[model samples]
Target: MKTIDLRSDTVTLPAQSMMDAIASAQLGDDVFQEDPTTNELESLAADTMGKEAALLVPSGTMANLVAVLSHCERGSEVILGDQAHTFMYEAGGISAFGGIHSRQLPNQRDGTLKLEDVESAIRQDNVHFPPTRLICLENTHNRCFGMPLTVGYTKSVAQLAGDNGIAVHVDGARIFNAAAALKINVKELTGSVDSVSFCLSKGLSAPVGSLVCGSAEFIAQARRNRKALGGGMRQAGIIAAAGIEALKTMVDRISDDHRNAKILADGIAEIDGLSIDIDTVKTNIVYFSLKRLEIAGEVLVNRMSELGIHFFELSPHTYRLVTHADVDENDMDEALKVFKKVMADL
Candidate 1:
């Protein structure tokens, strides 16, 4: 427990500078577009992602919901990976609140959706079928071992979406991690997409918030939708100040987290009872099955927590470890030692 917390990067604490910025931020009613700091954050985020405008929302989940509600009308369909955070973790807000239909495709080991499959899944112009209006993808996909969707892969799918007259949306909550890992520009990765939503809190270590960026016209529509969903907040500059700091300073250090993930993965791979495909780990999250250990995933999670090392399990047989800013090389070593001891007697 002394060293690592591998549950998720969402557990990361904000840096002192960010805290100071938040404490001293100038805030006004953001619902009235008067929070200057929030406005600046949105402008910078939109520019960074190569979009026309952006909106700040309370969380990445809300960002995704706002995007869906803005793009798809009730009874319309949106295509996405089955394992995507928007599909699997957002509690079907798009369906519950917007009445949107989701058309799901399997996520490959590399986190890219097959373009051919996406093309075939598009609904025809028929009265009975819900029209496919949007195609969604995740970069640095959280579920697929934090795998990064390559630029080529995204372009191919974006091409398919364009040819089929469907809009493309990227749930890029960990896009900076993706960019840093691939050593590519963020704008280049997102330029062809119709809209994108990324988190400020996860790897960036902002206390809370996410952003949705797209065409000016589209963003205007999303702003209205945000208010409709009660997502509009007043005087939100405190959070946006932290977001600004994260975008400025925390991005470059993500590779340290990526390197730590590899370190921990390599160590756990050497443990007798774990199975990990280190090759599939392109970013910060690591997933492996602990079947040989003959313990439930939750049991392992509890044991790890009690020992001051923490991790999350995907299912009964699958466990995951996510490295973040706080988990240094020393923490990785300590985690491995704990893993070996816990698995030795089993």
Candidate 2:
């Protein structure tokens, strides 16, 4: 049987057109900002996000890292959802390398931080308290079954942040998914935040690259921070060329991933030993639980892997499945068969 990898959208391989673009891309030393293809990609990314400028980085981690460094000073604090990729997945770069403090609040199941909680979390001018300098949000929030945050909520948060003289940053790694789901332009989602970092490697099907978009002055500072973190790359346009195509062609098709994810979630809900909230299977991510069963998630994962189906076990009894450009209806059908067989044996 062929492998059906639903581990994450990041597992998607570059398309043939992307590979072609990579081979023929114009190249130059990016340190001096002479790479035409890189410059074009950055410009396009900035415009798409409605920002004054953008900086390309090696990964979503690096993109968020530089954005954090740009927005906050040493010993300052940033407010974020406890389940946010920045607060949960990132390796404490903000606190460790930048001396920034993180203040985390519980993320609602729908992937939003309570405004009242945010208001209460802001530090007053006590000399001993760290000032809150930034507020971070994730669109298509990863840990929340990839729920898409709305423009109204984002704007409200931005207004609150502005009232407190704080900047807002969005970890929009799968922002296009959010846009496609909401039937809104990408700018509607990004305009409220001060900066946004989005990935081309995820559902976009690019081999690698993420872009950080923000004000021209902010990007100028972020570019310096990228170098401080050893992120400067030479002849990077080869990879950037694929990113350019990803933006041009790969965005609209993400709707198909969303549909496939719902189909997988619906099928899982029908399985006797599994449970899922089909409504929460938004965008490309579907999270399900085997908690009702006697089997451990790891064992079930292993059993499914043997059948050429792969995904991540989020906890001892929970698993996460992500649909992407590569996986289709046929792949989901095959995966469902494997799931049923594995459950029967259990």
Candidate 3:
């Protein structure tokens, strides 16, 4: 049987073309700001996103941390959704490394932090409270089944952040997915935020890295923060070359992954025991659960693995299925068959 890997888009390997770009990439020490390809990628990413400057970092986590450090001072607070990647999945890096505090509010099913709640959470210059310096958002929010937060929603948050003299940072690791889902240019959705970071590795299929873009001054500070975290790389252009190629040729293709995801979600929903919100499969990630099953999630996961169909856990009962460049029509069909077989055995 053919293997279907639906764990995440981060599982995607570089395409042959991207590998070629990597092999031919020019090299230099990026810490010296002389690596031509890294410089070019950062410049192009900044221009593409309508930001004053951009910095390349080793991973999305580094990009988010650098942005967090640039936006907040020690003991300052940053507000974000309780389910957000920055708050939940990032291992509390902001608080640990930057001495910033996280004030988390529950996210709506659609992956938005309630505007009114967020507004309420802003710290007054009380002699008693930690001052809130930042508000963060995620696009194509990972935990909410990859739902795309709308521009109007984002602009409202940005405006609210502005009202409170807080800078807004967008953890846009999959912002292109949101843009494609909303039928808007990625820049239009991101233009209002104070700083934004978008991944080059996920879905875009670059070998490594992400770009953090914002004001020139913010990026300068972010560069220093990156170095402080030991994120500064010498001669990083070899990997950066693939990032440039990924941006140039791969972003627009996420629509196909979205389409395939919809196909999988809709198909899985038709099964008797599978429970899924088809509408929530908005981007590349589809999350669903099995209803009243005798089988445990791990057991089913193992069963699916034996069938060469694969995914991962989000919770005790919930499973996450992601569609990416490697998963095409044939893979989706195989996955559906595996699902049916597993249900039958149960």
Clashing residue pairs in all predictions, respectively, total 2, 0, 1
- Cα lDDT listed for each candidate: 0.90, 0.94, 0.91
**Higher-lDDT candidate among 1 and 3?**
3
Report the error of model 3 at residue 135, Å. 0.3
Candidate 3 per-residue C-alpha lDDT over 212-259 given as tens digits, one digit per residue, 9 for 90 to 100: 999999999999999999999999998899999999999889999999
Q: What are the per-residue Cα lDDT tens digits for candidate 1 across 50-135?
A: 99899999999999999999889999999999999998999999999999999999988778888788888999999999999999
Candidate 3: which stretches are off by over 4 Å?
A: none
Q: For model 3, what is the C-alpha lDDT against the true structure?
A: 0.91
Q: Candidate 3: deviation at residue 89, Å?
A: 1.3
In candidate 1, position 282 carries an lDDT of 73
Worst 10 residues of 2 by lDDT: 289-298
TM-score winner, 1 or 3: 3
**Candidates in descending lDDT order:** 2, 3, 1
